[model samples]
Target: MTDTSRQFVLGKRPDGKPDRDTFELEKGDVPEPRHGEVLVRTCYLSVDPYMRGRMRDRDSYADPWDVGDRMGGHVVGEVVESEHDAWSVGEFVFGEGFWSEHSLLDGDDLTPVDPSLQNLSLPAYLGVLGMPGRTAYFGTLDVLEPDPGDTVAISGAAGAVGSTVGQIASLAGARVVGFAGSDEKVDYLEDDLGFDAGINYKTTENYRAALADAAPNGIDAYFDNVGGPISDAVFSQLNVDARVAICGQIALYNDEGVPTGPRKLPQLIAPRARVEGFLVGDYATRFEHANDRLREWVTNGDIEHRESIVEGFENAPDAFLGLFEGDNIGKQVVKVAEPSE
Candidate 1:
């Protein structure tokens, strides 16, 4: 069926903080899928902090989005039409769902989402069960291997990956301490999520003091999400042989360049701490195991998650901007279209 849908095109590259002017929304005809491809009616589109890096014209671990190109993101959708046998019509799939109402994906690019979760919100595929979930899974268990009772500290605790990390760490028998931007987030981590300790870094004048107050035993494992003063504080408070999982540097994403924080490599060296950076995409082969475990946790009530669902595909640009400002409580997702039965 011929379809016309609205999609956001990157209007201009942002030098620093992105504004709505940076994106231009326009309507376009949904092109038919070629052989070995499927037409996915985009149900939900994810808005992640990582997408900010893509909008900038700079060198990074991931490629930048070209000018006038559709904003790239993860999306959960139904197979409206399929030219490939593997992807039948009405199949739920997750793949590169750009900021659009409908998307085309090669048979190789799409991964089938759990059919049981169809009745649930589609954004859950982009949040707890998707990249964010996988990131927290492997990043904690694999990258930051911690023993029972190890003191683990996580920054950006209110965010998708950070929230998942705290929950997983608590389940893994670690004394979890989380730092977030607001008092509400801190309350969410400590009261709602059962984190051992929570601190609002935005209120605290000294993060070092806050870390010391929360984690008296020193940090055994650090999940570095906001890489700024908070990171430096955690680095300084690391115990001997601590492991640091370098996730997204959300603090620096909107800046013109990497902000200069206190240099603390000496602290890492003295303690022989291992700091490792990770991307969930690198662990795609093992995602099944991670998802299986995450699914079990969710099923058993060991893990609880939230999603910031923004209605309308046109609101994608606003959702994307909200990430940097910490406006989203949990996983940020844009509802592109209703799921097709």
Candidate 2:
């Protein structure tokens, strides 16, 4: 195999909002596999909001990337060379290959994908059948346990995880309400995804009124993705014994310091609402269980997925910065080098 590579590097830490200046594109030598590693030709790279936190200078649950380090995330690709028998040449797999054209992944980092679905497209492995789907599954089923006839509300309802959460709640017999930024996104949620109601938060001045109009009985469960004023609004409306799952907080990721807001601890105390924070990585033990159920849902048409794919590895930084601008309708991915079969 020819030795060639392209990778995205953190150019500088963002002062407030991230721009293209925050990233740098570079060419590099394709890595060779070590004793327990395999060389993977990158197929598709996942560009998630969480990557924003990783770009920061402070410590997060995940390690922060230095100014010149290659940015890391999930990728689905094919093994072209291997030093480990568990992954052989021509096999499709998911690995932490990042924004590079090629990567030497450790044995434990790769998960083999069924080649029978190769023509179905492997990028789906980075979205619905992978991490985001599992985030929705384990977060809702395990933490929320939404009951039949319950009204479930999801903020950031148009993104990958939020969209899946709404559909899963609907599948489990709950009345679903989705909050998104645009009429187009809200419309898709209501018309296609089967959410009972969709609110365009960008256009609405009174979010509480809109939420109340949609869920007359108050919210029984809330899957919060963007935490800020929206979460505070939802917090004040929880029904007794309501369950709230704290997922991603895109609204707070770029903030300069502790965000100030109206105190809402009273609402939780009054209703006995259970608000729990979860990191999807912590649920790895049951990933197979969640993956199987998500695959079954996809096969049965019970779950739907969409992707906002950017064309090149060089475009990863812009694709990532586009998240805060609401440029992606679903999972944002950068397609690097095509995997060799």
Candidate 3:
């Protein structure tokens, strides 16, 4: 095993969108696992839009990262050494791990990756079979609750959570309409993921007109991942009793102060729309059940998943910044290392 390890720390908190200067990569001795802890060699690191919110000094659902603190997120790794009975060397595990070549995690906090499910790649645990997938499953089925023939619309539709939510809503028999940032992503949503219609919000001059053409019946359910003008457009065209699941709001995540937009409450009143914001952590106790369903759908080819991987641990920060630029098609992850055989 290597005697040295490298990790990234928060160098500065940005007033707006963060850049590479916000991260500091430092080298140090590999940390040793203490009693009841396990040492893991990180193979894949997740880069998510929600991480942007965590960078702020203000409090949110997730704790804010203090300046100079090591960055951490969901990681898939191979256990290199273990002082905990539940884990053994060579086993793969998933847990909250640091942005480093290696991390020391409490065994109780880690979930063992099943070797029998080799049909799916290990990175799947960081995406479809993991947090994003479960978030989509619960948010679409439980929150949005689209009925058959419902016209469901999603913003930021090409992203990890947004893409998965679209597919799940489609499976529930909803005519899914997606709003994405680019033409390519719009094609991906309609042609590849089977979305009923897609609107390129960046290229389209009028979202209301686009929605009128795409979802002429008006929107029955809205899975909102981006909160901004796009959401404002969706809100303006809600059908009666429309269900809106407020997930991530990446559009305003980097703003310096209170972000303002069109008044939407009055519109909601006319539709009697139900809008509820949720964190996937709210359904922690039911994760196993959700995972089983997601796994079945994925393995049976009922659902298709993709990953946009940036090679090397050093580029983890770049992968994260790319989220804001809409650089990834599906899940954005960093390939840190090859797991030992």
Candidate 4:
């Protein structure tokens, strides 16, 4: 076993968009596992849009990480050493671990990875079958619950959550329209994911007009991943009894202060629309059931997922910063190390 573990620490608080200097790579000796704990060698580290919100020193659903603190998120790793009877060496598991080559975690918090599923790639545990997939599943299926023939509109349509939302929405027989940042992503949505319409929001000057053209039936359901102007446009098209799933506000994640935009509530009041914000952790107790359904969808080709993988542990920061720059077409993950043999 290797004696050293490399880790990334938060070197500085970001002013607006995070940069390379925001993280510091440091190496330390891998700690011996204590009783009831296990040592894991990380294979895949997840980079999510929500991590941007946690970078700032502010009150939010997740706690803020201070400077010099270890950056942590979803990781899939192999147990290298286990002091707990419940876990064993060579078993792959998933848990919230720091950005490091190795992690020591309590056995109670981790769930074992299925070796059969890992045959495709360990990265899947950090993306599709993991948190982002569940977020997309619950937000679209549970929150909005679009009916067959319902016109459903989504923002951030090429993203991990948005892409999954589009696919699942299509399966539910909704007329899916997605708004993406680039023409390539728009094509991926409309041509590859089977979305009914895909709008390039970055190039489109009139969001309301684009939405009107796409959903002439009016939007019966909305899956919002990017907020601000796109949301404003979507609100104006909500059909009566419209439902909205507020997933992420990535458009406002890097704002220096609260951003001002046109009021959208007025559009909702008359339509009796519903909007709700949710975190994937809120469905913890039911994760097993959710994972089962998602796995079945994936195995049966009902849910198609993608990952823009960064090659090394050292590039984790670059992968994270790339989220704001729209560098990835799907879920982003950093390969920290190869799995234990």
**Candidate with the greatest lDDT versus the true structure:** 3
Clashing pairs in 2: none
Model 4 lDDT at residue 210: 93
- RMSD, candidate 1, Å: 1.4
| Each prediction's TM-score versus the true structure | 0.96, 0.97, 0.98, 0.97
Badly placed stretches (over 4 Å) of model 4 are none
What is the per-residue lDDT of model 4 for residues 116-149, given as tens digits with 9 covering 90 to 100?
Answer: 8887768888877888889988998889998899
lDDT of 1 by residue, 1-341 (tens): 55687888889998789999999998989879899989888889998888888888878888998999987788898898899989888789998767878888888888888777667556778988889999999999999987899999998988999999998888889999998878888888888899999988878998899789899999999998888888988999899999999998888887885667687787888889999998888998998899898878876788988898889877888888888878887798888777765
Count of clashing residue pairs in every prediction: 0, 0, 0, 0
Off by over 4 Å in 2: 339-341
Name the better of 3 and 4 by TM-score.
3
Q: Tens-digit lDDT track for model 2 on 1-341?
A: 66778888888999888998988888878877889999888889998899889888879899999999988989988788899979788888996767787878897778888666577767888888889989999888988898899999998899989999999999899999998999999988998899999998889999888888999999999999998878887888899999999998999888879788888788899899999999999998988888888888887889878888899877888888888988887788888767664
Model 4 / residue 295 / CA error / Å: 0.2
The better candidate by lDDT, 3 or 4, is 3
Residue pairs with colliding backbones in model 3 are none
Residue 289, model 1: Cα distance from true site in angstroms: 1.5
Looking at model 1, the pairs that clash are: none
Candidate lDDT scores, in order, read: 0.87, 0.87, 0.92, 0.90
Residue 184 shift from truth in candidate 2, angstroms: 1.2
